[model samples]
Target: MSGTSGSYNAVTWLLDRNVDEGRGAKLAFTDTVSELTYGDLQRQTRCVANMLRRLGVRREERVAMIMLDTTDFPSVFLGAIRAGIVPVPLNTLLTTDQYAYVLADSRARVLFVSEALYPVVKDIVGRMPDLEHVVVSGNDAFGHKKLSDELAGENESFATVPTHAEEPAFWLYSSGSTGMPKGVRHLHSNLQATAETYGEQVLGIKESDVCLSAAKLFFAYGLGNALTFPMSVGASTVLNAERPTPARMYELLNRYNPTIFYGAPTLFASMLNDAATKNERAGTGLRVCTSAGEALPESVGNAWKARFGVDILDGVGSTELLHIFLSNAPGDIKYGCSGRPVPGYKVRLVNEAGEEVPDGEVGELLVEAPSAAEGYWNQRSKTRQTFQGHWTYTGDKYTRDADGRYTFCGRADDMFKVSGIWVSPFEVESALITHPAVLQAAVVPEADSEGLLKPKAFVVLRPDCNTDGLYESLKEHVKQKIGPWKYPRWIDVVDSLPMTATGKIQRFKLRDGAS
Candidate 1:
């Protein structure tokens, strides 16, 4: 929080500060395969920086990390920033073609890919003319320069870069409403800005806490949760490199006993529905849990608290704003709402005419925060539209109450009128999730027999649920819970909903296939 003025680097604030405070021997990170202490992290970070420099990756140049959650992640990520090199952490789950597109777009000079993921990017490596080296992390480097070889001769005594705080630090590719990835550039000051505002003010992250996040490091939410927030206060983090399934989550929870856990809404619902975990308490030492990526359904939130004895601090965040600017914190929480703006941020609900709407009306949400991204890379028009002078336009639709609580109303393009009134897909889905038989739900507008747009549902049911007379039962349940006009006219029972790699429901796909 102190040094963001002229010459500041995030490495000194997040990693080196802990070492200076005499937490050098304390565990900084414990991954599935290895653990790293603060002292080890500091030394490793410097070595990585020297390695990048030796590889001829110059200042302000790009390096891509297609890595899993591991102890090596922080060393590489912080090392790049410390030496004035930009590190782009990409989604490990992307296809080879997607990887090629992003690598070419960013023009990354070196790619540090994990050994397990080498197969995916192997064939595409030749197509990248700008990509100079393919350094593999694990053993069996697969005929490429290994990361250990690059760091072996390097000394752990590199000087930190005296880059301006407003200078670009890194880039995160965001697949906005169009589903195309564009590089979102963030400044050196943005990391600590989010840590101070949301991490310090809302979540109250501390040194004694141990953190676990089902959200991967590739995401903005995960970066703040597992990396910046915990490291900001000298806390420890547990990183899981494998899939975060229900059983796997419980295994980690029982083993590490993380005090703060971060996950998406769908994961929470599935965990609650998993037969073995139905009556289970939360992690023995869990003080709090967080839900993001999508709005938390009321039924899921209330049920989780009842069973686990902790609250799910459901909040709204994006790749553009970096982390949760609007959130439901510990005390002033309501299940279905995205609480309020964090202490250092501001939000507004604007109508189509760009005028701020009054409370109780739906409008597009815009946020004013210190951590907002500079703009999209190579997207001047979009950057102008999204990052307006002082406010960043969020593509979400929300309604505010008199007390400043914001309730999600689907996406701006997803809302449609039923009976000449706006219908929030989230509202209908929340109602559907309250029913005993329904495990998950997605609602989209479909043409009725009369050719009018009406609510239609796709639901994933509980394993023990009987399907006989189920559609009618669900219909009546939703009608009684919300209102008659808001109930779904048709229901399609399905095994799973279509989801993006980021865990968001691909409603546009459902709308395209609507009856």
Candidate 2:
């Protein structure tokens, strides 16, 4: 592996070098309605690169992508890098205010938005002073530069601009659970390290595999696992431009026969609950399954395996680290634990005093990975507090067993006090999720009239389950599993719990709503 000081760009390396080796290699992109071959993909990307250069997109500038998972995303993503511009992929689902924050924060010079989303931001573009260009993908009301017109009659021999390995290549934003979203910057080498560690070691992707993931390309996990990993191994990928429902996902699997499926635990739970209806269409060529973004309950894991005949390997990753740092391998998976740290990454459990904790004790999980980001962009104080020495202090809390498996407790900030005793929301939430009636659960502290805080639970019930007396039943269930003190004083049954774009339960939302 080359050191970080060397000059290398991931997009140029993967496309140019790989094409020189064998231009006939296969890469497929199948959306809900369309598909493209590797040869078509390579030519389109080069054309887009040449067009962007002709449009005066300068080196070291920021180009924002607000499109969903489509063929154009990869083309424009690689095109930006090939033109020496940093690609900042923004979540299309974010509110206009959130989008404005990112555009202002990144100082994006151009925004490539899909037609469906163009109307949402059409009136707001003038507020973004630094934005110099707007490229709309589909034909609609916005009279912006059409991406198709730009690629018309363009040559496919655009030279990739050479970049230093340490130069900024991309920007991914945090979930903003604690505050406003922070931009986490990564170098080109970080992408390569992530592909080598998580892609090769954990995912075990091969050229023959067809990779499919429910996460969007804007997310770090999806970008690494779904797009970059498969590209690195010369495999095919399935991209759905719409929200991936269980029924729709099953249809895609039946149609495409993807070999590797990656998604969040929430998606897995929904699929497991609705498997019987989709079983007849479920005879796809899936060989491996993976879950991330949140902890996978043992019951969900077991149910998915029973239905799909393949284990759903659980892993934990963060935007700061680029991709999965801990994951269970194919044959070494455990039912109730997130597997040991992946290769090229180090994990440690630290106490409140910042000392190493014993194997059986719960503490903060700190990570040291070659793919970890340099720091939060332009936030020196936060960068200093979060990154200490060579390790990134992940806010997650966990317990390590003697066998080196890790059990997630909760976030360090999520832990709160009740009756002067520390409480872990995940412990109670996990116990609640095991109940047959509960599909999902989120626990948080709520204060009463006396100014004393107590545990409150927000639960999403399974289908055909009566909410009558169900809250009491769940309270008793938790009281019996953990101590009575851990029982929630108030329980609210709802249709769904608030979640971040990455599928993490937003406990702070519950706390705010309850107040």
Candidate 3:
């Protein structure tokens, strides 16, 4: 691996280089709906670059994508990067108002959208003063130029725009759990660094592997899972345009038989519950299964391995860090601990005073990696606060063992106090999910009648589970797993938990709705 200095464009390194290596004839991407070979992918991306260039898109100009997980999504994204245009992949599940805010903030000159999604943003596109063009795929219902039409007769030999290694290549919006989503700007070399360190060194991604991720291309995790890792190593990926329900996932697995499957804990829990209800094993040909975006409960891991005969390697990463820096490797997976930092990254558990803490003591995690984002796009104050010097201060809290494996201890804000004793919501939720009937659980501090804070759980029960007296049984189960003091004083069985677009539980919503 080379140092992060000198000129580099990720588009050239990931795509053009693979073509140069004579792997262009190999399959690159596939979904239930479509498939593209590496040669075809390169040609389509070059067409996208030509189309953008014909539309007067300039180097470093921001181009936003609001399309689903199709071959065109990666084509447009890499095409923008190849042409030195900053690609901003927006979440598909966000509200129209949120989309309007992101479009206004990014001041994107052009937006590439799908026909299905164009109607949602059509009324708002005219209101965006900086938006010069609306490029839609599949249909031209709004009189916008079709992406396919623009690509017709386009040459397949566009030269990738040369960019400095430090220049901004793309931007990803944060989950915005704390506030409005801030654009995290990543450099051209950042993708290569993560692919080399985590993808190559940790995941050992091979050209023969095929990947399918429940996390969409809009997220950093999904981008790495679906595009960066596979493209970097000349591997293939399966894309799904629709939401990855358990049923849909099973269908994809049976059809594609992906070597690697990436999903969040929420998805895993849903799959487990679904499998349990169906009373049949969901077969998959996965060589490895990964869990991230949130903590993976021990019980979920155990049950998944029992049902599917594959271990779920839980890890941790952030939008600012590009991809997973801490991961459980193939032969050394710890069911409950996030493994040591990747070879190219540095990790430290720091106290509130910003000093390193001793082993087994919970503290905020600070990570420094070559692939870390430069800073928030337009947030100077926040950039200074989060990305200080070389280290990026992740808001996640963790405790490291003597052997260096880090155990997640929930977010700094997610930890609350009960009777002057601090309680970690992740701990309580993990305990609750361990119960046989509970599929998913979220714990938040709810105020009692006397204004005292206590832990309250909102749980999703597996289908056909008896709810009568199950609440008391869960309380006792949690008490036995942890301790009496940490047990939820109140538990509410719910149909489902509030989740973010990327499948993380929105604990704040539960906290707000708690009586």
Output the number of the lDDT-best candidate.
Answer: 1
lDDT per residue (tens digit) for residues 79-169 in model 1: 9999999999998988888899999999999999999999999998878989998899999788998988888878999999988888899
What do the candidate models score in CA lDDT, each in turn?
Answer: 0.91, 0.83, 0.87
TM-score of every model versus the real structure: 0.98, 0.95, 0.96
lDDT of 2 by residue, 237-335 (tens): 889888878887787788888888888988888876774555544546888888889888887888888877987889999999989998888898997
lDDT of 2: 0.83
Considering only N, C-alpha and C atoms within 3 Å, which residue pairs clash in candidate 3? none
- Off-target runs (Cα >4 Å) in candidate 1 are 279-281
Q: Per-residue lDDT of 152-231 in model 3, one digit per residue for the tens?
A: 88888898787888899999989878567899999888899989898998888999999999999999999999999999
CA displacement after TM-score superposition, residue 185 of candidate 3 (Å): 0.5
Superposition TM-score, candidate 3 onto the true structure? 0.96
Worst 10 residues of 2 by lDDT: 275-284
